[model samples]
Target: MKFTRTANANWKGTGMDGAGTISTQSTTLNKAQLSFKTRFADGVGTNPEELIAAAHSGCFTMQLSFLLSEQGFTPEDLNTEAQVTFEDGTITKIHLKLEASVPGISEQDFQDTATKAKEVCPVSKLLKAAEITLSAVLL
Candidate 1:
């Protein structure tokens, strides 16, 4: 299966002074200059890193949820944060931290399941970073 989104940007001038608008028609961002400053710190709007984080988090969460269900355990909640590190204009590493409120599961089982999810998740496989690490907490 394939997924896609569209973004349009209009830039005026150069460097940080330039601005653009972004729209996804999905309620989050709609035709606004990327230089909004709050989210991107004077970023030109919808930078690659932010988009990568969104994709990684969404993919990891879905994969984890599916694994949990397959293991006969339902997850109360799963919180994931993904950090994409860039060095010299290249993505170096992706750090994924997942905190889950899962019941009736041992720590080892949870770790094993999470490992499987990380390995099988499409995003993880797609990422070409040198390192991808996952730290999962069961509560």
Candidate 2:
């Protein structure tokens, strides 16, 4: 099986004074903003780090759900947050926080499954260069 996704950016001007709009094939993120302020400063725009965080969080959650199913439990809800740390113009680390509710599963089992998900999720593998930390709580 093969899957491909595409996004394009059109930037104008230069450096900190420049800004760009990004659009994806599906238009789910149509004309998202990217700029120096969005990247380095706290600005109301989308940046690469934010996109990576979102992708990681979504991927990890789905992986955990599959893991939970394989462990004979069904997850009721799973909430995840990925904190991508950028410093010195480099991605330093990604901290993942996951809170899950799985019926009929022990806390230890849920935690073990979540840890496994961290190791095997596609996005996690892709971002292996960065330090990946997981905090899982079973509710």
Candidate 3:
């Protein structure tokens, strides 16, 4: 399956002083504000790193669910948190913390499956330049 999704950003003024609003095609983030303060400091609004984290976490969780179903295991819950560390104008690391509840699955199996999902997920592949770490807990 081949498809495309898009999001638009509009910025005004300089990079440090300018502010922008991002709008996705789905309208999930219609005119969401972003600026230097929001990205670097603790300003209110969404930033690129936060958006990456959200995408990574969502993709990984969905991949895990699909893998579990393929392995004849049903997942009750799969919670994943992706932390993207941006330093020196580069993304240095991405850590994925996953807490999952799957029926009829061993700890080792779950770990292996999650690792596979992390390695194969679309966002994970796109961000492969960074060091990606995973901590999976079968709960």
Candidate 4:
């Protein structure tokens, strides 16, 4: 399946002082505000790193759910959080923390499956330049 998704950003003024709005094709983030302060400081609105984290977490969780279904294990819940560590103008690491509830799955099997999902998820593959790590808990 090959497809394309797009998001647009409009900025005005200098990098540090400029403000921008981002709009996605899906309109999920229609005219969402973003700015240098939002990205580098605690200012309100969204930023690229936060968006990347959201994408990674969503992708990984969905992939893990598919893998679990394939392995004959139905999950009660799968909560994943992706932390993108951006330092010195680069994304140094992405850490995935997963809390899952699956019936009758071994710890080792769960860990292995999560590892596989993390390695194969589309966002993970695209962000391979960053060090990716996972801490999965089977609750």
The most accurate candidate by lDDT is 4
Once superposed on the true structure, which residue ranges of model 1 sit more than 4 Å away at CA?
1-4, 36-46
lDDT of 2 by residue, 1-139 (tens): 8999899988999978999988899999899988999998888789999999999999999998888887788899999999999998899999999988888888778878999999999999999999999998888
Q: Which pairs in model 3 have colliding backbones?
A: none
In candidate 4, what are the lDDT values of residues 1-139, reduced to their tens digit?
Answer: 9999999999998999999999999999999999998999988889999999999999999999999999999999999999999999999999999999999999999999999999999999999999999999999
| Candidate 3 lDDT tens digits, 1-139 | 9999999999999999999999999999999999999999989789999999999999999998998899999999999999999999999999999998998899889989999999999999999999999999998
Model 2 spans with C-alpha error above 4 angstroms: none
**Residue 80 deviation, candidate 3, in Å?**
0.5
TM-scores, all models, native as reference: 0.81, 0.96, 0.98, 0.98
Q: Report lDDT (CA) for all predictions.
A: 0.81, 0.92, 0.94, 0.97
Better of 1 and 3 by lDDT: 3
* Ranked candidates (lDDT, high to low): 4, 3, 2, 1
Error of 2 at 9 (Å): 1.6
Compared with the true structure, what per-residue lDDT tens digits does model 1 show for residues 16-113? 56666666657477775565362446545566677788889899899999999998999999999998887876788898999999999999999999
Residue 101 error for model 4, in Å? 0.5
Which pairs of residues have clashing backbones in candidate 2?
A: none
Q: Report the candidate with higher TM-score, 1 versus 4.
A: 4
Clash list (residue pairs), candidate 4? none
